[model samples]
Target chain A: MAAHMTNAHRRFLQVLMSNRITEGSEARKLHQHCCETDKVYYAHDKLDDFISTINSHLQPLFMQIRKGISEDDGRAHYAVVNLAETEVTKMASDYTEMELELFRKTMDLIILSENGFASSTDILNLADQLKTKKMKKKEAEQVLKVFVEDKWLSEKNGEYTLHTRCIIEMEQYILSYYQDLAKKCNLCHSLAIQSQVCESCGIGMHLPCARKYFRGQTEPRCPKCNEFWSCDTPGVNRMGSQT
Target chain B: GKEKANELHSEMSAFDSTAFAEDLLTFMGINRTEVEETNDSEDVPADFLPSHAWQKMGEEALKYFRRAPTFHYMMGSFKSESPVRKQRIE
Candidate 1:
């Protein structure tokens, strides 16, 4: 209990409670809005400090405001993470045991895949094999949509992968669960799921990181092995029009 | 007739409106505490609105929200359960 915990902090936390996760820019706007509404001191650069104040109060409650990056866009994000793992089903309480089982299996597919994504056809194939309770393909399809709407998974072109919110919230769990199999981005040094691997050394860098690092270079080289970067640098062609 | 009229007058005196109003307000859980609080403030006029009740309610609600697990932790917990139990078919 910091003496400075004010209504502004409470209001900001209340909004975050409903949202669960927020991108950096939206969070900054929220910070300003909360302070203005509560008539508290506001500083654009002090958002992190303000969050820390709220986090301190939440520490005893086994919660934290964690910062992570968007794997696809390389932008910052903040999410509320729960550190406690009691016997109770604390996450997604609204989901049934069968749905959770499907989710876990889906995670297996995505994390183990070389591309960090699992096609819907493959995930839907898991619907019948769920050991908790076999689900009809139709029911499983609806559940997948709910998971996407809840921000746990993102889908594109029939491919499904962990959403940015999931990465930010689950980075530690994934890192520990997969251990050596989970490679960190060579440039940013955070866990990189959707990343291009170095052919020579086997280190990984996020596509965005690779794009930024290799920008304006005549030839892209691996940051780790200094070998020729084999993978197509994502968004390389669009760089010309913007620059 | 005089004795009946006297009994009616006594019954009417017993049922004071001010006292009855106070009792009704107290049973509804209003007025008492706020009246006492506002009594000390001569400049500010007293009204019936509850003070700090919403702030207290918000704090109580937030207590539950703060304890909720993030999605990863929930999934991890589910994963740690007995594989034998989870393998049961419907």
Candidate 2:
């Protein structure tokens, strides 16, 4: 028993030492990159760009660490930390890209619906419908407000009318946002009922869930798939039995 | 005996008056201001108020304003007098 305890202690110390070394190396590299670039790489205003740059450079290093750690009976602690951080970084990047794309698409939808702005009421009604279907109230409100603001609908004397441009804009934006949201849901390992397909990525998911995750009410990444989603899509339905 | 009785009567009369005054104040509901004044003078500590009081106050204020007459008018409803019914001459 004494010998076994000693062996275990030695193994623990070895693992700890290896982890410290790995962490030290990663920290050094990040520091060097920051110094060489002189551009505050990690703390830059453009988070998406920074995240992508880091991932592209650091992914291989993380894989190598993982390979080394997995070889030992006692998994290397630093390797796990590195893997988790990388996943988190990837998710963050994906979410930012999705959000930018959603905004761009929403703007385009507004421009297209500029003429038939009278249909804003219909869109609002649709928003209400979404709410009744268990879509988050705030999410529904935001999407509806975006449509109204885009001039797809005109409000006069407390009545809403859909603008011609609004219709086209709504259609295009909704289709794209819905599709991308779905794809994000899939990436996050969500089991939300698929609603729409992204023209760009061919993904689907519940709109309410997407909204919840985007608003920071829930974890920013999908719990299952760990994928990042754009915050712009309201009413994203998350998969799995919600506790 | 008469002197002692008079002193006791005087004391009872003063007590009755004080009780009557207190009852009158209560009936008139005029003691609320006095109570409020006393409370103000006591200087409650900042933490004495319930933690959620500010949030509740804000919500209540919002609800109150939402039900105000001007709010209804601003929401596009016209304030108009009802039409009078015509009565036949008896």
Candidate 3:
């Protein structure tokens, strides 16, 4: 039995050293390719064969281990086997934890934005976008906390408002959300705060400001209206007065 | 409970020689001492239970130790090669 176990272990080590383990997308592609080339063999069969080859090598050892249980003393045998199994499980859990930590560190280095805020939503979106990406939820949360601390995006009054300087730097991002609200009357340089949006272009304006900018013309145009312009058109001067 | 105990005992008795050796050692209350004892008469040292128990216990311990590597392999616990590959995108 001992000799059989040694042979199994040695075979396993040989297979490992030879890099015979199937892994990743490449393995999947290979399986697909093999399946396509050989009608008799399916991709799943190849995978099963790979697993069984490794299993066969180890079966002898398992048999030997089971052989150590005596019928006369059932309780003691079960206890020993159970203890050994528990030890193995504990070792596996420790290894999984270490692997998870390493994955988190790698993601932290790669996914953080320049300003240091790792948005949880962004990370989740990124994971969704990248099928090959692997990250645990706990690790993602940790990365987000680090990003918030570094980027200074702490919440105040239940809102994630940036610090003053960051707000200035993030002007474009802030403006994007409020672009529809920016309107001015054609006549007045002051910001237009109210009125029906112009039919020609979608823009709300203060009624007086619109009349003043149009020079008392019957067809009053919105000063800051983007009717003829798409949002992306550059160099189009805004009509609204600077606040 | 009595029926369950009987069932368990019967199940245990069905175990092979390797299991018998282990059981004998446990019954004798000798922990790992039998593992190092050789087959020689001096090694048997009559003070212990009969020589057969010593022989059987030694054989069982050795078998169990030898099987350790195989058991580790079967579970993929000791196998370094993971079926899943780490992907690197350039």
RMSD after CA superposition, every candidate: 14.2, 26.9, 28.8
Instruction: Highest TM-score: give the candidate number.
Output: 1
Candidate 2, residue A99: lDDT: 30
Q: Decide which is better by lDDT, 1 or 2.
A: 1
- Answer with 2 or 3, whichever has the higher lDDT: 3
Docking class of 3: incorrect
Clashes of 1: 0
Best by DockQ: 1
Model 3, span A1-243: residue lDDT tens: 222223333433333323322233444454455445544344453543543444465454331111111111111110001112234433543124333343233233222222223344544444433333555666555644543453323433322323222222222322332343333334432233223355665554433333334443333344565443222111223344222
**lDDT tens per residue, model 1, A80-161:** 7777666553444657889988988898789878889999999999999989899999999999999898888999999999
CA-lDDT, candidates in order: 0.79, 0.35, 0.36
Predicted structure with the largest lDDT when compared to the true one: 1
**DockQ head-to-head 1 vs 3, winner:** 1
Q: What is the TM-score of chain B in candidate 2?
A: 0.21
**lDDT accuracy of residue A187 in candidate 3:** 40
* Per-residue alpha-carbon lDDT of candidate 2 for residues A1-243, written as tens digits (9 for 90 to 100): 111222322232234333322333453444345434543323324323432343454456542112122111212223212332233334332122323233233333333342212233343344333212433445644654653564333455434443323222233233433443212244334322223233344454444444434553443454444455433354434343153
Measured with C-alpha atoms, the lDDT of residue B87 in candidate 2 is 28
Better of 1 and 2 by DockQ: 1
User: What CAPRI-style quality would you assign to candidate 1?
Assistant: incorrect
Give stretches of model 1 more than 4 Å off: A1-3, A88-92, A237-243, B1-90
Local distance difference test, candidate 2:
0.35
